[model samples]
Target: MKKSIQLNQDNLEQIGNHIPVPNYNRTSETADIVHIGVGGFHRSHLAYYVHLLKNSGEASSLCGIGLREGDQNLHDIFKKQDHLYTLMVKHPDGKIEPEIIGSIIDFKMGTTDPEAVISQMAHKNTRIVSLTITEGGYNFNPTTGEFNFDNPDIQHELRHPNDPKTVYGFLTAALKRRRDAGLPAFTIMSCDNIEHNGDMARKMLLAFAETQNPDLAKWIAKEVTFPNSMVDRITPVTTPADIDILAQNSGVQDAWPVTCEPFIQWVVEDKFSNGRPAFEKVGVQFVPDVGPYEKMKLRLLNAGHSVMGILGAIHGHPTINACVEDELFAKYLGAFLDEEATPILGPIIGIDLEDYKDSLLERFANPNIKDSVSRICSESSAKLPKFLIPTIQENLATGGCIKFATLVLAAWCYYSDKQADQNGEPLEIIDAMQDELHKAATATSSDPLAFIRQESLFGELAENERFATTYTDMIQELYKTSEVKKLMRSLL
Candidate 1:
């Protein structure tokens, strides 16, 4: 048996044939970017891009600042492996391409020491402070489209500004120091999946800053530039199985290997205060306005994922690949896009609508990727509004077909029942609003609007006669039988 290569800075040369190893001298590189959340998607996406830039000998490197205590796993793995990890992109044809990314030179866990993370952000070399802290991390109320000031973390940060606990706290404090010291502000870039994410980040950061110091908020509004971006890549949470795949296939044992589809895209606005890396060289699109692209991606791809994820979970599909394998589910997804979502969509520059839809189906069905249904299913409360609700709202405005989108919500209500699948295995309800959703879903026996009536989740859409009727009907049909193919067919 061939010996498994232990992944570390020293082992790069030994595994060059099996995986593309970075030839850049990582030790000499300084941190040009400080990414807030050091998770799988960031590893396979942004950091990977920086790795490409670093390999070109651009001297641009990264420092990962972790927020969640759960991120300690990343800190431990990167620390032990000399900040090296494997990125294995799987193709539909069963070919796996592995690359050892060496872009991240250091990591600081904020849960342990906020001061260190703040210092890294305030550094002169840190030209960009990026974030992938998930959708919920922004601490904004999804319904109101404003910062949730009542959040304990935001409150804590406001009270103890210097020794901060949240992203806002760390950002505001760091920027304040830089401002006071007369250093140029680093670009506040958000790589998350929110529409107008740059604006959202700026708003929340300034809101938090205002609570601490209004002067600081004013300075940030004037000095810092938060560039909106549309980032696309189906990066699943890495499983233990992925680690084993790396060890057996690539002759490398990576503790926290990031696996993703070969397709990756980033469309970023060119508005940056400080300088940025030459990300454009690595296929990152510098767009005039990311609005159209963001909508295209969020509605079609992300919203499509939620529909499949919820219904797939109820159908006992383990992964997205399995969901697309079912012809009925694929047809449902296509119909959802073409009939319900496409009419609401504006023109996407240089993208064919049909080709993009087909590509989404192909990407979802890549058998090797093993993207989990539950991973996409989690946080439906936040995702539905961001991804799907716009379609519903627009359809209502334009008088288009909304049956498909309504059914997607109904599927969510059914899936949120907190019960087992047909196999009698317990279905995990993983939402911030789990208890309320579960209660509402389970209480559909009394009032079908129990879940939909949640003002934060559905807003006034539940009151619409057309949507209300369709949603109620979906709930009734879901209760009668687990099969939804016929129901989906009826919409078409």
Candidate 2:
């Protein structure tokens, strides 16, 4: 039996060659990119790209900054490991590729010291201040698509601007400092999943700035550049089992290592305010527009995850792989993509729609990547609107069939209402509108149209006679029979 070695800067030399360690010298490194939200996706995607550049002897580095208290654990882990962590890429064929990433030179916590966070972002050398703050962190009204000033965090920041908490507060305070110091504004790049993420950041930041100081907002609008980007990589939440498995396989014990699917893509619009790294040199796509690419991905890959997720939970399928492996589920999923999603996606450059759809099914069925159903099922309110809902609306407008999409929502209603799987195992439903959704879903007992009547979410879709009738029938049958798989087979 091989002895497992603790992963850190010192242990890199002792760790065997099977697991590749970073050859770059960290002692003399300086990070010019301040990446906020140092979670799994960032580690696997952006940091991995930087690691490639670093391996090729480019002086690329990133200082990771985490805002929420939840980020503290990663900060401590990075400190202990000297910002060195393994990235295990699981291929469909059960191949494990592990590499120690050394692109992150340091990690900071905004929760512990906001001033230090601001200082780093405002630093002269920091050319790019990137964000991976999740969908909810934007502090915007999803319906109105405007920054919410009434948010408690936004309000707190407005009251005390100097001592900041939220990303908006930190960014505004930092950009103001750079402006006051007569320094060039750093490019505010968003690496989140939202379509036109950079545009959203600019909207929210400018809104926050306008409230604080018109002149500062004007400066930000003029001087700063927010580049729209589309990032794709399925990085599941790391598990203890993943950690232990990586150790047993590679004989290297990593505390907070990240593992992801084999596929990775980054389509960035070349709209940086200041200088940026030669990310293109390391497989980052610099496109004229990321809109089409993003739309294609969201409508297909993400939407597929959502539909499968809701139904998977109901059928007691624990992971995405399990969901796709089911013949009935796979048939319905393929139908949803081919008939529903693909038609709406106008035309994506350099992509074969059939091939892309095939790849999606293959990726979903990869047993090595045990992407959890719960992870996909979490935050249904935020995710469904962005990923799946638009397909339903678009198809509805064109007189196309919405049976697949409608059933997805109907299943979601059943899942939210039952609050458990077919086996009576309670699901950990994580959503911002959890209570409200449950109330609405359960209210269907009295009012069959309850869930669809959420004008905020459904937006008059309930008024559409065809959709409302179909959804009503599906949810009713789901309650009556509780046979999710049988229903899916009927659809196909």
* Candidate 1 residue pairs that clash: none
Please provide, for model 2 over 350-386, each residue's C-alpha lDDT reduced to its tens digit, 9 standing for 90 to 100: 9899998999999999998999999999888877777
Clashes of each: 0, 0
Per-model CA lDDT versus the true structure: 0.88, 0.89
Q: Which window of 10 residues has the lowest lDDT sum in candidate 2?
A: 15-24
RMSD of each: 1.2, 1.3
- Candidate 1: where are CA atoms >4 Å away? none
Model 1's lDDT to the true fold?
A: 0.88
